[model samples]
Target: MRIHHDWKGLSPEARGATVAMGNFDGVHLGHRSVIDAARAAADAPLGVITFEPHPREFFQPDAPAFRLMNAESRANRLGRLGVDHLYELPFDAVLAGLAPEDFAREVLVDGLGIRHVTVGADFCFGRKRSGNAQTLTQLGRELGFGVTVAPLIGDGRNEYSSTAIREALADGRTRDAERMLGHWHRLDGEVVHGDKRGRDLGYPTANMAVGGLHLPRFGIYAVLIDVLTGPERGGYTGVANLGVRPMFGENRPNFETHVFDFKADLYGEHVSVALVEFLRPEMKFDSIDALIAQMDQDSAKARAILEAR
Candidate 1:
């Protein structure tokens, strides 16, 4: 899918399209319902209007990381869902100060020339979030566009939402998050060189920094790793440790994945790791041998869990 960073000078092919608008953090089931609403609006190309850095992050720069998926990951998932264009609007001071009517007039009508737009029932926009779905519909009437407010999708017990998914991940409940997301919760990054301690311990790992990415839990997890851009471009069942390495006296968090029985140089390669299940919380071990022994056990359990599926 084509990603348009700003709405300025949009191509003719990108104009007059139907768009699903929101933050779309995880692009979970509820977000999909909104997208489906846009698709049902008319026989127009499918597009998405989402914010970059998220409005929350823009307002609260010092807040803890809470993104379910980064921009690249979100775009990849939306592309898989058949989005033809992604309007990733920058969330800066100027854009954040836009009035409700001006946002609709400048962004939807003048910028994108959208023929139809869809948003969740609870969606709000513009400065101070003063506009709701009703406001959007009323604006659409004046702006010469159709508006759809999709109802929240739920599983009878819980609503499918990014907040619910974040709560599940914070509690180390990957399965629950997956149920709401309709896919495993994944972290994507480029493999970088590490201390090489895993090599000496007989468990070579591909390390990736988790900079600004919302960490699930500082623990070991059963994961499925996909090599997205490398010679080893394929999926592999693996075990990963997502933490600051308390045993090694490291403060910066990173994801270290040890691909089971696989040997390949993955430095500088991009990969996506899906958390399947949480194994155990990270703890400081007295000796290196103790850590290796626990790692051996974690590997066996992860292999069994992965193979069973």
Candidate 2:
């Protein structure tokens, strides 16, 4: 997909596309439905309009940090979904204060050259979020563009939403989160050098450090880690511990994965780990030997689950 951070970067031909606008935090199932609908309606390109540093973070600094699909990950997902253009704008004080009509005129019409607009049913924006779906449809009629508002995509009582997915992950409900996301919850990071605790136990794990991005709740998970390169370039069954290594006297959170029946030197390499199932809560063992013994059991269970899938 063509991704442009600045308005000036968009081509003249790009102005008349169908546009879908939102934060699109995790780019979950609901977000996909809106983007796909816009793509189907547009004779021109399909443009995805998103904001960096989600406005909620700026507006409510005390709010829980967002569970976001980072720029690279979002781009990859959008490409997979056949998006033609991605417009990621900086969310600042000035942009945040734009009146609903002003945003529709300046960004949608003037900048993006949008012929049709799509948004989630609950979407709101511009100057105190006064721009509801009804407002947008009204504006679209006046502006000579079409507006499409998608109904809430859900399974009976559970609405498919990024917030709901975040809650699921935070509570270690991987399967529930996956149902809402239309895919497994994943973490992307580089393998970092660790204290060799896993190696000493004969489990040899690749450790990843969490960043500003959101992470699943602290626990053990059955995961599939795809090493970015090398002979083992594809997915491998593994068990990951996401938490402070209380067993080893570490005071900071870490992601440590033990690849079943695999051996490799992977420090400094990047990988994407998909959490398939939550195994158990992280616990401190009285001895390293006990931790190692428990890991053997976890590894066996993880292998069985991955095989069954």
Candidate 3:
């Protein structure tokens, strides 16, 4: 998909694209509905207009930094969803201060030459979130563009949302989060070297230094990892520990995955891990033998879950 920072980045041939505008944090089912609507509106290419760093992160640093998907991952998912263009606008004080009409004029009309636009029914934009879907529809009529406010869709009981997904993860409910996300929650990071304690215990693991990625609740999980590397590169269903190794006296969170039946060195290599199901909560083992026994149980559980799925 073509990506642009500004409308000028669009060539003479790039006018008249249909746009789905929003934060698109997770690109979950709800977000997909709006994008699908834009795609259905023919005579224009499908485009997604999203913000970087999420305006919430910019305006309120102290706010919980929970995010369903990072910017790059969001773009990747949107592209897979058939988006022809993904406009990741830099969110800053200047852009944040735009009036409703100016935003429509400068972004939707002038920048994108949008032939049609789609957004959630509750979508709001412009300075202080003053603009609503009604405002967008009204402006579209004046600007010769079509506008659609997609209805909220839920999995029967409750509406699916990124926030809800995060909450589910925080509660160690991978299955619930997957229901909303339409897929397993995942993270990508490099496999850095670690204290070799797992090796000492006869259970080697690939360690990744956790960063800003929103981690799931502290627990052991059944996970599938794709090693993006050499001839040994492939998918592996494994068990992962995402917490401080309390049994070993570590007081900081760590991510260690033991790939099943695979003996490839992943040091310094990047891999993406998808959390499939929660196996158990983090527990302090009285001895190394006890930890190994619990790990054996976790591995068996993970294999069963992965195989069943």
Candidate 4:
């Protein structure tokens, strides 16, 4: 997919696409429903209009890291969904200052040249959040473009939403999150060098930082790994620890994943780790041998869980 940073002065190729506009944090089922509406709205190109730094992050800089995925991961997901154009517009001071009509006229109509736009029923825009789906529909009437407002979606008991997914993840309900997400919850980043404690323990792991992402339950997990870059690019099943290393002396959180029966130097390579099932919370063992024994049990259990799928 082609990603455009700026909304202005597009090549003819980038203009006049039917696009879904939202933060699309998790790209969950609800978000996909909106995107699907955009696709069915017109025969034009399929595009997604989202914000970098997420408008929430832009407005509340001091807030906690709650994003499900970073920009790279979002782009990767959109590409897999066959998005024709990705307009990741900057959420800056100038853009934030626009009034409702100004944003609809400047960004959607004139700048993006979008043939149609789809947003959720709750979507809002403009200074002080004055615009809603109804407001956009009215603006579309005047501006000669189509507007679609996708209704809320949910399972029987609860809504399919980012907040719901976060709650499920925080509670260590991996399958619950996946049901809402339409896929496993994944953390994407580069493999960074670690202290090699796992290597010494005979379980060499690929370490990834959990920067700015919402923390899932602090536990061991059965994971599906995608080595996204470098020569080792492929899929693998493994076990992972997604918490601060309690055995070692560290307070920062990260994911340490040991690919089953695999040997590859993965430092600096980009990868995506999907949490399949939560096994247990991390614990500090008194002896190294005890920890290794527990790890063996964890790996065996993880393999069984993955194999069953």
Candidate 5:
């Protein structure tokens, strides 16, 4: 799919599309319903309009990391869903200041030339979120386009939403998160140099920094690693530690994965690690020997869990 960073000077073919609009963080089942609504609304090309840096990140700069997927991951997933075009609008001071009607007129009508637009029933837009699905419908009627407000999708209990997915990940419930997301929760980053403590302990690892990615519970987990852009280029089962190495006196959080029965130089390679199951909470051990013994047990348990899958 073609990703457009700005709406200005879009080609004729890029405009006049049926758009699904929202944050679309995880691209979960609920978000798919909105996209499906857009596809059903028009014969025009299917497109998605999402914010860059997320509006929540812009509004609450000091908030904890809560993104389920980064921009690159989200775009790739949307492409896999058959999106022909993706508009990643900047969520800067100017766009955030737009009033309700001005946003609808400038962005939806004149800028995108949208033939139809779809959004979740609870979607809100404009400065201070003063607009709703009803406002968009009214604007579409006046602007000569169509609007669809997708109803909330749920199992008559909890609705499918990014918030619910985040909660599950935060609690180390990868299966629950996957059930809502329709895929395993993954962390994507470039492998970087580390302290080599794992190597000294006889378990070498490929290390990656979790800078802005939403951290799952700090624990040992069974993971499946995919080498996205290197010679390895395949999935590998592994055990990973997703936390600060309290035993080593480290403070910053990172991912350290030991690919089972495999050794490869992964430095500078982009890899995705999918959390399969949480093994145990990260803990501090008194002696190196004790830590190594526990790691052995963790590795064995992870191997059993992954092999059984």
Candidate 6:
């Protein structure tokens, strides 16, 4: 998929796309429904209009990290959903200052020349959030474009939303989060070199930093791993520890996965690890032997859970 970073200029082909517009943080089921509406709206290119750094992040820099997925992960998911163009417009003071009608006139009409736009029913836009779905529709009619406000989706009980997914993840309800997400809750990052403690313990790991994200429960989980880059790009089932290494005196959380039956060196490779089940909460072992024994148990449980899939 083609990713455009700005809306200022465009070749004819990149403009006039029937696009889904929003933050698209996780590209969860609700986000997908809006995208589907856009795809089904017209025969133009399938596009996603989103902002970099997310508006919330920009406006509230001191707030705790609450994003479900990072930009790279979000892009990969959107590409997999068959997006032809991703207009990842920069979010900044100038963009934020645009009035509702000016945003519709400048960004949507003149800047992008979008043929149609599909947004969720609760979508709001412009400076100080002065616009709503109804505002966009009226603007679309006056500005010569089509607009679709997709109704919110629910799973009989709870609405499919990022907030609900975050709540489920925070409680270690991986299955519940997956139900709302329509996929496993995943963390994607490049494998970086670590302390090699897992290696010395006979359970080698690929470690990834988990800063600037809404963390799940600190625990061990049965995970499905996808090696997204380099020569060993493929799928693997593994047991992952998604927490700070309390035994090692580390306070920053990291994702450390031991790919079962795999012997590839994965440093610097991008991998996506999907949390399938929460096996246990984080705990420190008094001795290396005890940790190894618990790791063995975790591996066995993970294998059984994944194999059953």
- Cα error of candidate 5 at position 239, Å: 1.3
lDDT per residue as tens, model 5, 105-125: 898888999999999999999
The candidate, 2 or 5, that scores higher on TM-score is 5
lDDT of 1 at 270: 88
Question: What would the TM-scores of all predictions be?
Answer: 0.96, 0.89, 0.89, 0.98, 0.92, 0.98
Candidate 6: regions farther than 4 A off: none
lDDT of 3 by residue, 1-309 (tens): 877776655786566788899998777788888888888876778888988778889888787667777765676578768888888888888789999989999888887788898999999999999999999999988878899899989989888788798899999999888888887787667788999888887779999876555778998999999887666677888999999977878888899999898777899787778899998889997877888898998999899999999
Please provide, for model 6 over 1-309, each residue's C-alpha lDDT reduced to its tens digit, 9 standing for 90 to 100.
999999887889889899999998778899999999999999899999999989999999999999999888898889889999999999999999999999999999898999999999999999999999999999999999999999999888877889988899999999999888888888898999999989999999999988889999999999999999999999999999989888778898889999999998999999999999999999999988898999999999999999998
Pairs that collide, model 5: none
lDDT for model 1 comes to 0.92
Clash list (residue pairs), candidate 1: none
Model 2 regions more than 4 Å off? 13-15, 228-232
- Candidate 2 residue lDDT tens string, 1-309: 787885554678666778888888778998888988888876888888888767877788777567556666676667768888888888889789999998888878777778998999999998999889999999889888899998878888877888788888989888988888887777776788988888878878898767556778888889998886565677788899989877777778788998877877888877778899888888899987898899888888888888898
lDDT of 5 at 301: 97
Model 5 spans with C-alpha error above 4 angstroms: none
Which lDDT values do the candidates have, in the order given?
0.92, 0.82, 0.84, 0.93, 0.91, 0.93
lDDT of 3 at 235: 82
**In candidate 2, what residue range of length 10 has the lowest lDDT sum?**
64-73
Looking at model 4, the pairs that clash are none
Model 6: weakest 10-residue lDDT segment is 153-162
Clashes of each: 0, 1, 0, 0, 0, 0
